[model samples]
Target: MRCVIAGGGPAGAMLALLLARAGVEVTLLEKHADFLRDFRGDTIHPSTLRVLDEIGLAEAFHRIPHRKAYGLTLVTDTGASRLADLRGLRGGYDYIAFVPQWDFLNLLTAEAAKYPSFRLLMNAEANGLIRDGGTVRGLRYHDKDGEHELRADLTVAADGRGSTLRVAAGLAPVEMGAPMDVVWFRMPREDGDPGETFLRVSTGRLLVAINRETYWQLGYVIPKGGAERLRAAGIEELRHHVGRLLPFLAERVTLLGSFDDVSVLTVALNRLRRWYRPGFLCIGDAAHAMSPVFGVGINLAVQDAVATANLVLKHGPSAVAAVQRRRMFPTVVTQFAQRVAQKRLIAPALEGSLRLTRVPELARIPVINRLTRTFIGNGVRPEHVASR
Candidate 1:
């Protein structure tokens, strides 16, 4: 079978690699010339590690430079608490690996290149769907040369949250309300700084610091549609806010010299009511745009790719609906958890209510911590690479 996958993000790359390894003809199109974008989802969960292990890439993947985070710590005005202890999980790959996403993608694409059936078109952007009657048969894309069209038995949209092909195919996502947006930037890490990854929450503010060895990848959360106003407050005001929340970073907050350094990620939680059409399917963020609550978006997308490959390689194009059916439950459950956290915890914290007073006590319970870890680390129904 021949397949044309739009977008070379996690889902697209993994799906293409699996199908090609199974001897299916696959062409993967990536709009970007390279995968060196800043602050892309870098959290590699255990579920993804298991997928890599199944495909025999785990050892090589471990060679890449990355930091390991065993758990998350939450600090609030009331007190501090351990959010989830991932180390206690039964899987051998319990820790979350924080590797640069480009390194991860480059590894996948490089391995995929070893297979003759896999074709990667860098800088090629999918412009529209090629339709025969009501079914999508392929796609039309243009690169540096000119417009070109490729025909395939199946078209998979893995183009990300703002997917062009999904829109071209007339698929609309239902937005489930997100209370905040994240401003991501980097700050220097001092030797004396808090070693564990943690979120510091104060009145009207929230900050998450992910250890990147030499620096801390910071996510400053603000109310939805509040980015412009925050910019108006100036960088110094923002710096002061950071200093007030996490006193240790007060000295290095100045590293964010200007607003230009900060990237705004407008958060959204939404999914398509229908994930596929007659000859086409949408997976990953193309089907369900996830809020970056647990940093599980990438893992979930990888899971989607595995499920897609497992079904498609076995049943061909007829398995499209089965892929959706298998993945929909996990998507719904994860999104529901994220929504609840946003409503009960994050939103109120941003609105200046210290609802996190119970976190400290809750963290002491062994069963509660274990359950939280399982939910965050493993997800609902992790898929394996059955195609191999």
Candidate 2:
């Protein structure tokens, strides 16, 4: 079977690698000629970690030199939450690991190359679906060479939240309102790992301190479309918000440099009511896109690839029902992101008496900080990947 995957991102590449290894002909297409430095979905979830182990690519992932997370911490708007330790998983591996999105994509692309059956065609944009009745039969694509078509037994859309293929297939996504957007950038972490969670309530924000090699991914949720205004106000004004978001790290203010191309992304949480139609299936962000909380977006996408590949290899089209059933529970990753959005945005604003009692300044209290950290790793803040 010739399996053609759209989107050279992690999900598409990983799926191609798995199918190719299983003796299937694979064609992977990526629109970008090269991996861009700045991108979204940086952290790799622990569930994804377990999948890597099964696929025999865990060591290769580690070779990428990504930062391992020991635990995560959370704070109220006042920045009161201290560090919560998430290393309680039996036999060591517990906390979520941080890595640059580009590096992680490159790692998967390299691994996909080991399979002789897998062929990658970069700089190719898949424009539409070639259908046999109601089923997708192949793809219509356009590149510098104008246009062409390729046929495959199966088409997997891993193209992401804004998937053109899914849209072309007429799968209208159901959107759950995620009303917040974020500003992302990098900053130097002088000491200790950058895998801490800082949630401050008074300032109305959430911060994910992701540890990279020399810098950390510092994210802050702003009112929808605040990024344009922030940069317009200049770096000093941006720092004011950052300082308010993470008071503990306020001393490290000077170390925080450059916006690194402030990215404005709203909480895009949605799922296609139907993930598969006949011979076509959508995986990763194409099927669902979770909010940024817990870094579940990319992890869920990778998990979808593994699950879809295993199901196809095991049962072929005969297992379509099983495939649909299997994906339902994992949809909770989207639900989980929704829950975080509520905690961070809706519940806080609407919690009448609770909001009054929840002192934003009390986040600086040591015990309060400890309590916040306690809730992060096991339940809320850190990453979760559901293994197949």
Candidate 3:
């Protein structure tokens, strides 16, 4: 069977590698010339590690430089608490590995290059779907040279949240609404700095800091459509806010010299009511755009790729609906949890109500903490790599 996958993000690149390993002919197209973009999804959950181990790349994956967070730490106005103990989870790979996403993608593509059946076309952007009657048969894309067409028995859209192919195929995702957007930037980290990834919450402000060996990837959350106003207030205001919330970073917040250094990520929570057409299938963020609540988006996308490969390799394009059916439960469950957190926790905290204090209080309970860890670490119905 021949397949053409658009977008070389986590889902597209992973599915390509898996299919190529199974000796299937696959062509992967990436719009970007390189995978060196900043602040892409960097969290690699244990569930994804198990997928790598299944494909025999766990040890090699660990060789890449990364920081490990055994659990999530939460600090609020009242006190500090351990939100989830991932170390206690029942798995060989228990900790969340925070590695640069480019490293991860490069590793997958490099391994895929070993198989002659795998073809990667970088700097090629999929412009439209090639349709025969009402079914999609392939895609038309353009690289530095010119426009070109590739025909395949199956087409998969893994292009990300704002997928061009999905729109071209007339698939619209139901908007679930998000309450906040995030400003991401980097700050220096010293040797004795707090090691674990943690969230610091103060009245009317929320900050998430992820340890990145030499620096911290900081995410400052603000109410939806508030980024312009925040910029108007000046970068010094944001620096002062960060300093007031986490005193230790007071000296280094100045590293964010100007608003130019910050990048805005407008969060959205939505999913497609239908994930497939006659000859095409959509997976990953292409089908369901996830809010970055638990940092599980990448892991969920990886699972979708595994399930897609498992079914499609055996049943061909006829298995597309089965892939959607198997994945819908997890997508719905995770998105539901995100919506609840946005409504009850994050939104209230941003509104200065301090309802986020309940998170630490509830997390103190052993069973509640265990259950939270299980849901975050393993997710709902984690898929395993099936033999081709």
Best by lDDT: 3
In model 2, the Cα lDDT at residue 236 comes to: 78
Model 2 spans > 4 angstroms off = 76-84, 191-197, 229-234, 247-260, 318-321, 333-337, 340-388
Q: lDDT of each model, Cα atoms only?
A: 0.91, 0.69, 0.92
Error of 1 at 360 (Å): 2.2
Compute the lDDT for candidate 3.
Answer: 0.92
Clashes of 1: 0
Query: For candidate 2, lDDT tens digit of each residue in 1-388?
Result: 7788999877897788778878788899999897775747767766667667777777877887667666544555433443445554532356577777787778777877887988888899998999999878889888899998989888888888899999988887888756567677766666654344444454344455555657666766666556777777877777776777665467666564666645656677788788877778888788877777656677667766777777888877545455556775667644765677566664454332224234344335567545543433333222222222
Query: What is the per-residue lDDT of model 1 for residues 1-388, given as tens digits with 9 covering 90 to 100?
Result: 8999999999999999999899889999999999999989989999999999989999999999999998888888777788778877876788999999999999899999999999999999999999999888999999999999999999999999999999999999999999999999988888988888888887788988998889889999999999999999899988999888888888888888999999999998999999999889999999999999999999999999999999988888878899999999999999999999899878998898745555564546899988888888889998877866
1-388, model 3: which lDDT tens digit per residue? 8899999999999999999999889999999999999988989998999999999989989999988888888888777888788877877878899999999999999999999999999999999999999888999999999999999888999999999999998999999999999999999999888877898888889989998889989999999999999999999999999999888899999888999999999999999999999889999999999999999999999999999999988898789899999999999999999999899879987999876544445456899878888998999999899963
Model 1 misplacement above 4 A: 355-358, 361-363
Worst 10 residues of 3 by lDDT: 355-364
Q: After aligning candidate 3 to the native by TM-score, how far in Å is the CA of 221 from where it should be? A: 0.3
- Given candidate 3, what's the lDDT at residue 78? 76
In angstroms, what RMSD does candidate 2 have relative to the true structure? 4.9
Q: Judge candidate 1 at residue 12 and give its lDDT.
A: 95
User: What's model 2's lDDT at 86?
Assistant: 51
Q: Which ten residues in a row have the lowest lDDT in candidate 1?
A: 354-363
> Quick one: ranking by TM-score, best first?
1, 3, 2
For model 1 the TM-score comes to 0.98
